[model samples]
Target: MKFYISTLGEFDIKVDGQSILRDSNRMYRIYKLFEYFLTFRNKKLLPETIIDNLLSDSESEDPKNMLRTQIFRLRKIINALIPKGELPEKYMNLNFTNGYYCLEIGENTIVDIDVFENLIQKGDKEREYDIESAIESYQNAISLYKGLYLSDNAYEVWLVPTRNYYQRLFLKTLNKYIDLLKRNEENEKIVNLCEKSLLIEPFEESIHIELIEALLKIGQNKSAMQHYEYALNMLEKELDAKPSAKFINYINIIQNYTSRNNDLDIEAINKSLEEELPEGAMYCSLEYFKFLFNLQKRKSKRNNEYDYLLSIMINSNNNKSINDVFSVLKKSLRKGDVFTSWNDNQILVMLHNVKENGTETIKERLTDNLINYTRINRNEIRLIFQPVSMENTIL
Candidate 1:
């Protein structure tokens, strides 16, 4: 029988054709992680590494022990859910060998992410470049985006890059789709498609800009301006930045063709108001951005002005990405904003009264916890340090 893991996107998961995993979203994610092991059963993929990446930073318990418990839990449920012969095929896929879990799976059976990626590769490679065939492939790929790719689970550290790649690809295909519409002179269709693309990747500039342009081309300047303003607000609020000169210029150029500045009210052209920004960075209101600094102690405050400022800098950085590089701060962060890191040798501490502790006390607790953690895992690897301070930061 063919193996398939059913992901309800950010929702729960199902195994094979049964409800092995339930309404519990995180456990459902854990089950999805096993798919990687099932797919690549030939190599020993360490359970500890998987745990480090899969569990939240708040989850600091020994995963080697946790793995055994989780496995027991999974086996009981899976064995009950799956049929006899099918059970062996699924369970055998996860091999406990040489002190770790190994994975191996046959080629191309992955869900629609691979399907679209393969199609994109094929379409790009063809001399004639069959847009129609490519569109069909993209349609298939689009069908598979059940919501977000692996959205509900924590899998591995390296998997974040892979996951981001697919998210980017999903947005990329929308642009290609719009071009196909443009070639066919289907201008009205572009607006709806652009709107759909924006929902998945609201931060992507191209679609945001395109949505406005498509509106303008169809004599919908009012609607165009609305979308343009909305896009502007999203970027500025999220990143503390403004739009690029190109987007402003395009909107300005379109408005210039109009009788009145009803939508984009400006005395002069946006080109004159053009901003210098790094590629992929937007412009925003610097004055409105709030940096939440720590309440410092009066005694130590005299010497640690630099530290206080660094903490503010870290708060400024909170506006950078969707969440963070790892996901620790992301879950803890309110509104899930893109915040900066405290440029300190951080530690992952499981505390009894984290809310009551002072900053330095908490920081010391973290440092001690981290040192002990490293000592326990020292046999696996050497020391690694990421010092977060104002002097060494980019954001």
Candidate 2:
């Protein structure tokens, strides 16, 4: 497939048209710098701005030499793609005006994003014109998306706009795809698509609200209400904002029918969880635990868990600083294990799995681990351990 990097205006490098070894880190950086340039194609992105965009907070001294090396490598890659004899003249024809390399491929270029956007827009019209054509466009749009538009780096100014633009385009295409599916009476397919969209873009309040709407359209009011509440709560907690007026209106409509929005099927899970709570497992106050666990279960990457767990831990410990407890837990986990100091003075150790008698060994290992960790800080952080098993051991 041809590799087209849209810098100034979106340059095309047809690989099938030419070949080059394009795996240098510098080449990738230039690709990114060009990407940023493409997003703000009309504006002249400066070299210093590109350097600042590329550097991390930890990066020292603006590496001009490094950047120069990358630009050279990018030029070499472009040159290597040209035929040996006709290269110099054809390349000289390209522009590098005012420190910004440009790509003036008019409309014939097969850019994945451009193709996706065009097909998505045409898909919408095709829905009106012809069902077969619309389906074809949606398929084409989905195919061209590749992955998230420049999902490599978010902090890079170049990557961010390109990422956001492509992301918005991807979602637009996805919504159009869902709309087409809905028109075809493929409600089941739409439900799955809505679910996947919500997963990919949980921050998208509209999509969640749409999910609820779609669920309700299929008479799945029970599940619909659950999603509506989840979506609203997510917006409130993460964004510190209320649900949109449209969503509130949706909720009001749902409530008017039969208080269906308030009805929840949490009793079953609660009952199971309660049964697991031993005779005196100290399940005193658990709202925060439930919230943290739910958030982690849904999306493990949410950093709010750390603050939430710390808050609960500090609050429960008679306002005493539970910093040692937090430190011990944080240091104990290898990489992907979840351990939370949710209860003040109460530290819960979460391990993936241990051998049959490994729980006992793990308990001792944990105690030793905490002692070693706690002593270094010289803080009084005596913690209790509660191992809550999800699907295996009962109370």
Candidate 3:
């Protein structure tokens, strides 16, 4: 007789071809005992340990007796579920000796977690030598990780560590598999793998970055930008934090490459800037902001003009879009200054020939303008003036 126990997404058992559902009190407790015993099947557990792991919350005063009764119930259920003479005598019995209980297993019994671990080991061993076989093994293992382990028992403290351990293993195996795909220059496969991984770990920044990079490699800049925006919004909303500098630089690269039309001569490039005024902040893309910032640094070194970068994030009592805040900023800031949206909620501004005190005055004027022009409350607008030198980068 073949018995299968699956604990990856949910705790389920199949005896032969029929599944055991939790439809009866006897069946439910039997399932719990079977699951607990299979989880540590190789070891003989004391009644206290088994009770603690399986029935720690039970209201029964004498858990040792309860555990003995559960073992008996488990044996009866196994006997009735499996046909007569189908399972070996050893497999049919719940062995209790010297105050220890164990679920004796037969050769035909299978557990999904054990199979998953074995496949991972095989994949790791074969990846360098045989790519196709390794990928097959990895795919098999990845499919086994349907979702969080013992998801029905997610809040159980005892399950947390085991769940996290399996999760880490799954991710490690997946990342290695992805690296192998990358070695084969399988960009589409890389994107697919990243998307699959993200389904399980949606907030994983590394996976998101990898997906974006893969899409960019295939000239899918628009798709990559959409993912970037999604990731940016998700991270900010969930973690109250920004993405890493590496991620922002990747965005800058994508935008810079996508925005290029053709090579322009020095005179044409110079003429493009002729209409811009010298004082109010100029709005630009992240790529353009980076270029102008570098240009300003070079010019500052030669001309001895002190240039600084300031970051502004509106603290609005009501949520407002970046365009609304930018409208107020355009009317308030100096004409020669430049600015760009670091994200939807923040802006990076370049101020030329400004000292510490000048920034304070600029902050006050911007605050007043935001409240007066946009009707945002004065207390709801916050101006953060972080002075960045020519040698530094700001996001």
Candidate 4:
């Protein structure tokens, strides 16, 4: 009988194509003991090491005896996994010899973690001389990693380092495979691979950047922009930090892709530039807002226009409240006004054709709008305005 074992993403064992491990039959100590033995299979493990690693949290008066009892139970489970006609010793063995416990499996046994590491090693060896071969090996290895290693045992202290090692190896393999795909200009494949990789590693900024780059290459400009926005929002909301400069650079790349047009006719250019009439205030990225702010500042100076910069600060710790405040701003301000998030807790707006006296009226309107549209208290929302002509500081 052949044994099939899987420890990545989940822990499972199958004998002769039949699953032997089930949740219904799972006992805490028995399952953990079996998992520990399988993880360190064929290695000498002292009783002291086993008890200290697995039973340290529990109070055991006789830990050595407890370890022996658990090992006996594990041996019974392994024996049951053997086929009815085959000898149990031929399939698997659990033994204590030379003052060390060891679990040994037959040569016919297949373990996914062993195969995963082997494929990665094969890819590393082939990468220098045979690019296509290396890519294939890396792709196979990456596919084997369904999720974090032994995710079912996530809370186990002994599993953390090993789990992290496998995860990092998976990322490295994925990046290498992506690099080779890039060399071949297989952008669509990169897009698919990076998208799947992101589901596994959503907080991975590099994968997001790669996904955006591939989308741009394939002329999916709108999707690229949407992903960029999503990534930015995810980083800010989840990590409570802005994306790295490498990620931010994608904005310029996306803009360049979208703006590239061969049409030289003036009418066509104007048609391309034409956009729908604004319904309410316009919202933009902080980067774009800086550009608009500077242009508006120069225009106000030359034309002596009444332009005011409004800063709205939300004091609440809730992200939902901050989002609601932005929603209120969009509906309350005029179409000519523009705004952007200044930070996690603040928003900046450029109000056109508004004077110092008019600022008070606008502030009152915003205050009322916030109260009407958002659950945020009046005291939680603060608004301040300064004329564009008087502002010389950079964003």
Best by TM-score: 4
For model 1, the local distance difference test gives 0.47
Return whichever of 2 and 4 wins on TM-score: 4
Tell me which residue pairs clash in candidate 3. Answer: 278-336, 279-334, 279-335, 279-336, 280-334, 280-335, 280-336, 281-337
lDDT, residue 278, model 2: 23
Whole-model lDDT values for every prediction: 0.47, 0.53, 0.71, 0.79
Q: Clashes in each model (backbone N, CA, C under 3 Å)?
A: 21, 3, 8, 0
Candidate 2 lDDT over 300-384, as tens digits, reads 3433232112111222333434565455555554332334444345444333323355555644654576557544322433333
Higher-ranked by lDDT: 2 or 3? 3
Model 3 residue 50 CA deviation (Å) reads: 2.2
Q: Please, what are the lDDT tens digits per residue for candidate 4 over residues 75-127?
A: 88777777787865566788889999888877767888899999999999998
Worst 10 residues of 2 by lDDT: 276-285
Report how far residue 302 has shifted in candidate 4, in Å: 55
What lDDT is reached at residue 232 by model 1?
61
lDDT of 3: 0.71
Candidate 1, residues 1-395, lDDT tens digits: the string is 43355432443333445533565656654575565454344677677766765554636467667776766665566456545655455433445667887644434223445556776666455415776776666555665665455555545555566567767777776667677767776777787666555555566789877777777778775555545654564566545687777875766665564434443655343432342111221222221111111111111232232222212211122232212222433233223122333333221111111133244553443334433432322232122222222233222
Off by over 4 Å in 1: 1-3, 6-8, 11-20, 25-43, 54-63, 90-92, 105-110, 125-127, 154-159, 257-395
Ranking by lDDT: 4, 3, 2, 1
TM-scores, each model vs. reference: 0.55, 0.53, 0.62, 0.66
